[model samples]
Every structure is written in C-alpha cells, then in structure tokens.
Target: MPRPGARDPQAPVATADVSTAAESMPRGQRSAARPIPALTLVSHPTAARIGERLLLQGLLAGREVALSRNAPDFTRPGEPLGLPLGDPFLSRKPVLFVPVGEGVRVVPGDEGRCTCAGEPLHGGREFGPEELARGVPLEFSGRTVLLLHLAPPPEAHAPASLGMVGQSAALHGLRRHIERVADVDVPVLIRGETGAGKELVAQALHARSRRGGPFISVNLGAIPKELAAAELFGSVRGAFTGAQRDREGFFRAAQGGTLFLDEVGEASPEVQVMLLRVLETGEMYPVGASRPVATDVRLVAATDADLEAQIADGRFRAPLLHRLAGYELRIPPLRERREDIGPLFLHFARQELEALGEAHLLTPSDPYAPPWVPAALAVRLLLYPWPGNIRQLRNVAKQLVIGSRGQSFLELDARLAQELRLPQTAPHRTPPPGAPTPAPAPEPEAAARRKSTEVGEEELLAALRAHDWDVKKAAHHLGIARSSIYDLIERSPSIRLAGDLSVEELTLCFHACGGNLDEMVRRLEVSKRALNRRVKELGLVPKDA
Candidate 1:
C-alpha cells in the first residue's frame, strides 16, 4: 500500500543544466520530457509552508498512493518537495490514488472530503493527463489546495528570485533559465504575453552579467517610426531639426551593459537593419555621422507578437530575429501557473495593507475569525484566465485590500463580482470553537452544466441571447466558470471574429452605428480593437487609413 502521490523511483529527474536547457524548447517538445505525475501544495490558510512539491516521477499505471490526516510522507524530490498535510479535518483512513492508463483514479476513504475540478469526491473520479498538465486543482478540508501537475524535478541551483514571488515548479524553471543565460553575453530573446515581466527577466540577466555599465530599456513600439533609428543608434548635433547636442542613443547609454529592446517586433525596417548591423559587426553609425563608432553591448529583446508570422508576411526580418534569439526563454502565463495565485495574491495584498497602515488586516481578528481572504474567492481567483498576467493580479490584490478596508473579510461588491464572475451575494457559515469561520464553501457541483465540455452549441447560443451577449452574466447563468464560457464563445460557430467579418458588413455596421465604435461593437457583436483593426485595414476609417 503506497501513500498518495508517491514518487516513482526510476523517473528521469532534472538536474540544473537539463532544467535550464528545456526552457528554450517548444512547449510540445518540453511536455515530452516532463512525463511523470506530481503534486504541489499551492495553497493553505497558513501559507508560509505552501509550494511543497512531490514528483511521482516514475509511478506507473497500477501503482497506488494514499492520502489522509496522517498519510505517510515521501520527500525525495529536491528544493520544493511536498510536506505532510496534517489537516485535522481529513479522515484518518487513507484515500487511495491509483494510476490508470494516462489518468489517475481517485478513490475517497469512507470519510474523505475533497473537491476535484470543482467537484466533491464521494466515490471515485478520473483525471486525464491533459487536465493534470493544466493543473488539476484539489481543494482539501476547505483549507488547502493541491495542484496535480507534471514534474521533472528541479534542483535548488538558482537562489535569486529578483523580485519574483511564488515557489511553483514553473517559477523554479524560470529561475533556472535566468541563471543559465545570465553569465553568457549572447543575445537572449524573452517571449511572453504583456505584463508577464519581461523587463524583470531582462534585469536579472543584466545583474548577473559582468558588464559594469548602465542597463537601458526602450520600447520600440512607443517610439515614432521616424525617430526609431535615432532613438536606438543616437544622432549627431544638427543631424535633424532640434538635434541640440550629440545624443547618445540607448546603445551607447548601455555601453558594455545590456540594451533591452521591448516590443522588438514593432521596430521599423530601418531600425531592424541598424540592430542587425550592430549585432553582427559590433559597430554603429549614428545619424549624420560619417564614421562608424565601435560599440560593445549585450542585447536582450522581448516581444509578444508572432515574429514568425511577421517574417512569413515580410513585415519583420528573418535574419534579425535569428540573431536576437541566440538564446530564448518563454515565460509561462499566469493561468498556466494557477497554483501560485494564492501566494501571489497574499504577497501583493500584504504590501498594500502595510502601505495603508492596515497591516492588522493580515491577521485574524480572533482565533475564530474567518480569513480576510475567503476560500471560495480563492477558487475563483485560481480559475481566472489572467490575460494581463502578474501585473493585473497585483492590481486586483490592491483593490481587494482597499475595497474591504472596514470589513472583517474581503467582500465582493457588484464591480468585483462582475470582474470575478461570482455573485455579489455569498453564503455564510459559523465557525467551530477555537476555529476561524469559513465562508460558505462552494455549492456542490451541479450535474447539468458541471463542465464546458458538457454544454452544447445550441445551449451556448441560447445562454448568450438570454443574457444579451453579456459574457459575465451568461457565464453565471450557465453555471460555467468565466474562462470556460470565453472558450466556448471562441469555439461557437455563430460568434464571428473581426477577421471573419466582411468589409461590406463592417461598412454597413459602421454607417448604421454612425461610426461610433461602441455602437458598432454592440451591433456587430465584435471586440472594439479587432473591429477597429479590420476597419483600418479596409481603409474605412479615415485617420487610420
């Protein structure tokens, strides 16, 4: 009888070098290497000890592990190994976990109480490998959340976070990426969505390098195309109108240090050529300067755009891209690391609380008081697809601390409820003796629409019409989480992307709405920016044209 989440003895584990190298691989290829199942403790009421990981590295099909109040501890994995649960509310008898083919069979003990994929486990449930990769969230005893995910066992080689928070395995992988590339002077490409902290990655690289000069950052997209060349490679006095003294561009400003070019995909053709020349020849010719000046600077570039697509369309240079990507690192989006939300929210919330002189809010009002942050709320936070990544999460944390200033627990007003896709009204329950009150736990999973997979196309359209296309309200009405409905909308045949709309339809809607973007959005049922882009592409909008 093995304990729950047991490690497989023969699995290929990640040494520091392997972990760092894998960061550059395509996600599909990377998944092939991390084939073993693992559990990471992501959340707890007392979160100081969270982020413990257990790599069931070699646990094969038919092997079993158990979980209970005092399940046996297995701690062979390094750095962030999982610890004992020690939850008094858990049953004394072990809940069994058996690996089926590519999924896991979770059989609850007679008294076991846990929620899987927002479902209560009364008997047994199966979680497929895909769900595990996205992190199968398991809430236990109403006080803990464990993420069942893939593991490749990261070593504790990198110690510096450089202002990053959370101890998720993904974060550990990111740390390894930074360390492995830091000492080298090669051009590193950081690819991630906006607000995913590309600049932080850039800084970490610079800090570890031997370069002693200043680190300079510039957003090429923000600079006008006419000035991009001068902005990056500097200009001589009298080179152009109002060029007072010789302007030292970002390249010279950074000198021997790093020049971090953000939004590199947005660089103009002229600027791209200039970048390529300097990267290849170690020399740059400033605007109106006859002589090429010798330069030495490590370059790191970041972008959210599809550079490959840009190259295929002849919008970006292929050789410039290849030069920039001598090394590459992809930051995992926040949704992919949902396990970190609790700790990240708490980390940001406490900082805001401290700034407002309300640090006391971090502590319970009494031994029996409810948590300032409710567990149900935690579930919603974890499930949200954070398009804005860590920056948006931090903003929400500040909002939570400030919005619930006078309350005993964080309360959702209409704004927050709409934002979180939870109802404004929450159920309440009393606390036991010497225990903190838990908000009413989430209602047991409703059988009808428990999953997005269960909802049909007809049902999805009906919900959309019933709610006037208000996604939040419709998602609430359908009993699916916000991300699920958004996904469904993406998949629905009737919902047209702006690209799918014809010029004739857009022009008709444009005139019908009197060129009002908001009205066009309402009448066309398309996103404002996408619609605007399509309109501009067709020369329907004069200024854009």
Candidate 2:
C-alpha cells in the first residue's frame, strides 16, 4: 500500500532522494518500477485550465539540466533531455532543475504557474509528496497528466552553501541565474547590502563552474590606493623600492579557475583603466613589467555600493561595470526573506553544538536546545529586522546554544535585547484617575477547574493583557495548551488582539524611528519580538535596511 495521504504506490513521493528511495525498495519492485522522466508533458484538460498542460519533470543530480518542449537547436541546446511536448503554447525553456540533497527540484523558467496534481507549486517548491503520490494517468485541465519515473540519475552531493535555505522567489531566482551562467566563462557582478552574504554567492558560482582551478578572492577596498595595481596585477623583482622578489597577484593566483574581486567599486581610476584593458584583451600587465601576462580566469566581481551612481559620478567606469555585469545577481536581505530565519538558525545551532562536542544534547525528539527551542525562537527571530543579516543571526544562535543552562524557557530575553542593542524597560500600566481599581491576582495553579472550563474570549484577552500579550503565559492562565491558544487566535479572526495601534500608526512610528528596530521597539513600548511581528504584519520594510 502507498504511504498515508498518498494516491498510489506505483509513484511514491519524490521528496526523498532517488538513491535512498530506490535502495529501500525490494529488488523485484525496484526493477519493476518505471523510470523517472526528464520531461513529462501531461495533457489533461484540468492542467490546461491551470495553464500547465506541459509538465517538464527532471532529476537534479548536482549538475545543471534543462527541460524544453520545442525541438532542440544545435545553436541553443537543452541539457540532459529535450522532448517535444507538441504544444506550441509552452515556452521552449520552461524550467531548470538543480539538485538538492538526495532529491530533485525544479525551477520554473519564464512560464507563469506550474501545478502538481492540480495543486500549484510556488517558486523553489518541489514536485513531490502529495503530487508525486497522485501517480500517472490523473485527469486535470481537460487532459491526462502523465508520470514517468525513469531510472535515477547518478548522485552528486551538493555543497552546504548551495543550500541557500529559503523558498523565497528572490532566492530561487538567484539560484536559477547561477546555474545558467556557472559553467560558462564570463564576468559576473553580485550586488547586495553589506553582510548579506555576497561572498557566499561568489563561492557558489565558482563551485558550480566547470573550471577546476583554485578560487581566489581579492578585496580591492582593503588595498591601499597606491598598491592597488601591484596587489591585483602582480609585481616583478626590483619593480619597486624594496627590490623584493617577483610576486604573483590575484589574477595569476586564480589562473585556470575563478577570481572573485570583492568591492570592485573601490577600484582606483588607474586600476579601473587597467582592469578594463585586461578584461577586454584577456591579459594584464604586471607593475613595472614590460610584458603582459596571459590570464585565464573566470572573473566574478561583487559590490554593496551602487555602481551606477558611482559611474555617473565618474568614480567607476561604465565600460568596466558593463564588462563585470555580464550576469548580475541580487541577494535579498534577511528581513526581506524572513521565512528562512528559522531553518538558518537551526542549521547554525547544530553546527555550533557539533563543534562543541555536544551533539548528544540535541535529542531526536528535541533537536533544538532547551529553553530556546525552534517554536519560541522562531517568534523572536522573525520579529527582528536582522540588520546584520545571516552573519548576525549565526552569532546570536551560537550565544543561545552555549548559554541555555537547562532552564524551562532559557532566561535570555534580557540578554537578547541587550545584544540586539534594544532599550531595556519593564512593561507598566496605570489605572485611570478616580477609577475604583482592584482585585487580588488569582493563584493560577490553584484556580478552580470550573473557572478554567468557564474561560471565554474576554477571560483569554484579560489573561493575555495581564501577561503583556504573551501567548504561552495566557494559555497557562486559561489552563489550556499553548497550541490550543494558537488555534483560538486563528479560529477567532474578529477577536481584538492586545495591540491597539493601527497599521498606519505603527508604520509612521517605524519611519519616525529612522528605521532603527531597537528605537522602534522602545518607542512602541513592546517586546522586541512582538514589535517585529507587528512590523511584519503591517508589511513594514525598514527604509535603512
């Protein structure tokens, strides 16, 4: 029988890597199973209705491959397989597949929407689990959608950096661009905010490239203006004052491989002129050297600065920017892709635990460290704007893991606020003038079962307010599980949440705080995490970030 919620056993879920799944199957069953398809064009009417009549499926085995519907052209060929779907409506190249883990993943090309078993697949989402289990011969969009599980492709392990760890469209687009240009010899420009992992993207490009030479990175901004040329283009013996021995620069060091020039925007005028000449002629002249050396390097340049503005100001050369930006990749900041925070934190935390030789501390049932588990941590993580991006988050996770002293809730809220540079203040409230106030606080554990059972929306709201709108605290007061409290929040949409500020008012305050999250938290008089959530709910993007 197929797995639970599965439609058929003939085509099991594609979530698991092909190797593991194939090895698990019985020898006889494995041989009987159909081969995985490089391109499966389903022609069901329901699929047609969903604008996905042509479903081009393929394997992601580390190497990049393309799935196309049109006939293959010698001038512009598709990788792995090229099957004609007989549907002219579909684009020639609808999607590209990049292997992740032991499984395959598909990235939609310019094609609008892709569906599996009638359910739409968002960007970076794989076609497996429910859709794969639905099997072949399923009817959709007024035609029969076909499933072909051809023999699995060879397994190739992907590097950890390739695991960009997000399902956001921005990340998917970045991966797609990298796959398209990785194998080719070209100049690429990577632009993003500082600490946004620009070097990681450069490394990913080099890792995926066919060229197997050493990867060298040069930080142009760090080099003194006078030494720029010598640092990048080398200097021969007796070329300058010290009469030092001949030294190979970044260009020669990265021969036959990839050369990443970080902060290329910092290139001096003389350096820019030389760089332009070398990029155009495929050679560079060493400082004080009579002859030009033949350079064989795939150049990938990155900058957090606005090169266009620099060009306009005559600080950066237009031609050089044009040359370096043969293909451009933009990496969105952490605040922009908050969905990735939880996974990234867990990944970093595990790495720290393993490094500290405390792997056993993470039980299979609770891999996340105590006090600051995934569920609670996710709320805090998603709330902050993550000004320092991934680098900042990694530091935070390391601190949390090392500091969790076997407490129930890991009493680090104050530490986190301080570390985040947020202002520290206790929550407070005062009764209205002349208002008759007061009743003794109820002993939560001693509260009668009847009173707990009689809890209603008003009681829940009061508890939440008493605890400063903490979900867990409110749940305990109501004698219910935290998950049940979450369910209540979801089911009762009309219930007034604790916060009284409107979206516009919160946005105005955020702007007034000059997009500083710490300042905004203090100004709003809320917990750092709570403020983060409200900002997200209002779809606020810190102007500075």
Candidate 3:
C-alpha cells in the first residue's frame, strides 16, 4: 500500500518546465504554452521532503498520470501511470493528470471531491494559457497544493514600510509589478479589497521614485464634498466664509514627490472633472483664485470600488479613470496568499512588542526568534480566512501579544478564540503535571439558554430585530456564537425581522444610490448578489428605464 500523499515510483520527478514540456506536444498545439506548469508543490503538510525529491527527479511528461492510493494495472489500455496518494478523503482514484495538446488537463478520478484553482471541476478542466499562467492551486481532501510553473524568477523589490514577507509566487509577482513601475511618474491606480495594503503600495512607489519631496497622503472619501476642491487645491484668504489664511493644497505639499489619494472613487463628478483638468494641464486654480499655479507631483490613486461599474452608472468620469489608470496594480486578497500570513503575523507581533517596550522579552540572543508564537499557533493562523486581510491580522497580533502576557499556549488560544471568535485548536504547550484538568466550558449561548430558559426561535428573532439584523450583535445579545444565529436564519427564512428592509425601502435605496451597486451595498450593508436578487424579486424598474 502507498503511504499517504505518495509520489509515483517510475515517474521522472523533475521541476516542471512549460517550454520544455510544450516541445513534447504536437506543433499545432504549441500555442497553449503556459508560463507556469500545473501542480507544483511549494509545501505539504506531510509530504514535502519526499515529494520535493520526487519532483526533482522528474514528473511524467506527454502522458496521463492517474493519482490514487491503488496500484497501477498494466492490463489497462494506454497503460496509464498511477501514483498513489494517501488521503482518507481521496477515492481509490481521485484525480488524473492527462497530457492534452500543448497543455495538461486535470480530470477527477473515481474518488473524493477535487478542486482545480479553487473552482470545482466536475468534468475535469483542460489547462488553458490563462489558467496555466495563473498556476491555480489544487485541493483534495481539504489539502491545498500549489502548482509548479516554470517562469523567470521575479526581480527583487524592497518596500520601505512592508519588506518582502513571503516566498509565494503571487507575492513575488506583486513585488515585480512594484519594481517595474515605482520609478515611473505616470498616474498609477492601485486597486484591491480593503486591508490588502493599497497605501503600502503607494508608499513603496514614493520610496522607490526619484523625487525627493515629502509624500503627501489624503483620504478623498474623508474630505467633505463641499470642501473637496478647496482641500485638494488649497485656498486663498477669504476664499470661503471660514477662510482665514492662504493654505497649500495636497498637490503643493507633494511638490516634486508623490500624492497618494486613497478612496478616490468617493470623489464627486465635479471633483473628478477637476482632477482630470489638473492631470492634463499640470496646474490647479486655488479656491477663489484667478491664476492657475503650476505644480510638480506624481498622483497615485487607490480604491476598493469598481471604477468600471461606477463609470457605467455615470458616477465616475471615464476620462479621469483613463488618466488615473495609466498603470493598474491589483493586490491579491489575504485568502489568496495564505503563505504570507505567518510571516506577517510575526512581523506585526514584533512591532507590537517593540511598541509596548517588551522587546527584551523576546529571545535575548536572537531578536528574530518568535518568543511568543509557536509553530502550532502559526499553523492555526495560516488556516484562518482573514476576511479583513492584513489589518485584521495586525489587530489579532496585538490582541495575542497583550492577552498572552507570557502565558501558556492555552492562554494564547483562549485569547485568539475570544478576539477572533475562532474555534479552539490543540494547545501547543501541555498543562503542568499534577495540575487539575479543566473541563471544557459550554458555549456562551448554551449557558445563557440554560440560565434563562429562553432558547426558542422567538427569542432569537427578537434579538436579531433588536440588533437591526446584524448577526454579530444578535449573537452577542443572546450570548451565542454568530454561526448559531446564521444557522437560525438559514433554517427559518421567515424569522427575518418584519419591516427591517422592505421592498419599497430597497427601491428607494437603489434609486438614491443612483443605481451604483457598490454604494447600495455600503449604504444597506447587503451583498451585491443579495441586493440584485431582492431588486429582481421586487420587480423594481431599472434606473435607465
């Protein structure tokens, strides 16, 4: 029997090369050459050492390789090579890698559920140039594995605020993008989900640029609409009712440097037009000033909003977007780059300890050693989804460092469970010998129900109504986990608070938002899909109609 996650004994285990592998395919199919080969192992929970060696030897080229726990049968047609993988969830044959034309196709074997690049492939998926270039991850039996692709190593980049943290290809790719464009003075639009560090990218650009002036950062969304122009372009004495003296605008402050405008999507149409003029003319007129002042500044704008959708809704100016997006850089979300979480957490923890003047508590000999965080804790950290991305990770690090108080792993886990609302995992450190074994406490909601005898659906609905349908608030009120509230909602759709969000209210919000889905999402706190579904269900007329 093959050990768990075993490599093929006969398959040549070498690092997969796209160009070399493509040469083996027929000439007509050579156009499908991928930048990265599929199924490159970066790290494995159990099989890294053996798997890495097996890969170094060689992988099957120009042939189908079936992966399962069963031995290959020589009698089968084509005599397909079989590599056994020891996974409880895998079927006798779970996945098959077939050489198709110029690329390899990944098909499911007669086994457990399999995912290619996070997407379920019921009928299997043939690798396309785009799909192979991205080097999507594969998942089997809750185990994730990175695919190998042969490409040039990314050029080095060292951001001033956030040094290179992970060895993952995605992070490396992001660094390459920054390295290529940092010195360029053209407007760059940095787009990503919130907490993905758009501001850090702006800082990196400024640090890498040739300009010497100070970097001026502004949050456009935070600026009031009425005062946006004056705030961004400066104002002369008596420019407005409260104008006391001449003040330099962000552009003037960033002269010969970078001006990072975050949340640029929040700028009004008038502001967008003003920005376009500034970009075109390299000059701005101060509030109540007749003369245009020439200024030298490189603009870097960032937003989580979808500019294309905003443009379609007539809320964002197309010309401004075109000018701003001279070079677009999208930072991947934390969930997509799980490899970075551990290192980032350590980095944040160090910073937190240093801030608290507890730097000495870390290993006295080696400053880089993780004094508080253990390997098990690190694994747990990596497993988390981190919906809030780096920002949430930093907050968690802060809580752990403070809450742990140089205590045991049990204390640390408890702190994490309380702050992040995570389930407790096995403790890294064992309890003291001869110590009394503590019994597991019941869930907060269970305890509450036991005490008050008010655990019915009516009470749950009442709590949800009291909290405006926020599951977190309702869970807190009922002393239960938020997941329990979600379960309640899922089990009984009719339990939703009446008049909480009526069809008329949704229609008004839709119109009030000018049909901008993102704005509506923010205002109503509903997902885009939910909002769209509700609109269709209500038969609301389109804004265009």
- As for TM-score, the candidate ahead, 1 or 3, is 1
Better lDDT candidate (2, 3): 3
Give the residue spans of candidate 3 off by over 4 A: 1-162, 355-376, 408-410, 413-415, 418-545
lDDT of 2 by residue, 123-208 (tens): 63443422232222221122223332232322253212375664332454466567766865667788765677889888888888
Better of 2 and 3 by TM-score: 3
Prediction 1 global C-alpha lDDT: 0.69
User: What lDDT score belongs to each candidate, Candidate 1 first?
Assistant: 0.69, 0.56, 0.58
Write candidate 3's Cα lDDT for 1-545 as tens digits: 11223332233312111112233336786554333333333222322111121121122346566665353321111123523334344566546676655455667774336654335666776664444443444555444243433332222432222365544446555665677677655677887767778898888888888347789899998999999988898999999899999988887888888889999999987788888888767788888899999877878899977575567567889778877876777776675555455456657767877787775554334323222444334444544556567888888878877876655221356546654443332321223336686876544443333322345665665444334355665676677666666666655533432234676767888887677665565445433455666776777654533
Cα RMSDs, all models: 14.7, 22.6, 16.8
For residues 418-506, could you state the per-residue lDDT of candidate 1 as single tens digits? Answer: 76663433322122235665555554433335788988875666455434355665677678887788788788754656777766778
Best by TM-score: 1
Rank list by TM-score: 1, 3, 2
Candidates ranked by lDDT: 1, 3, 2
Please list all clashing residue pairs in model 1, or write none if there are none.
3-65, 3-66, 4-65, 4-66, 8-58, 53-81, 53-82
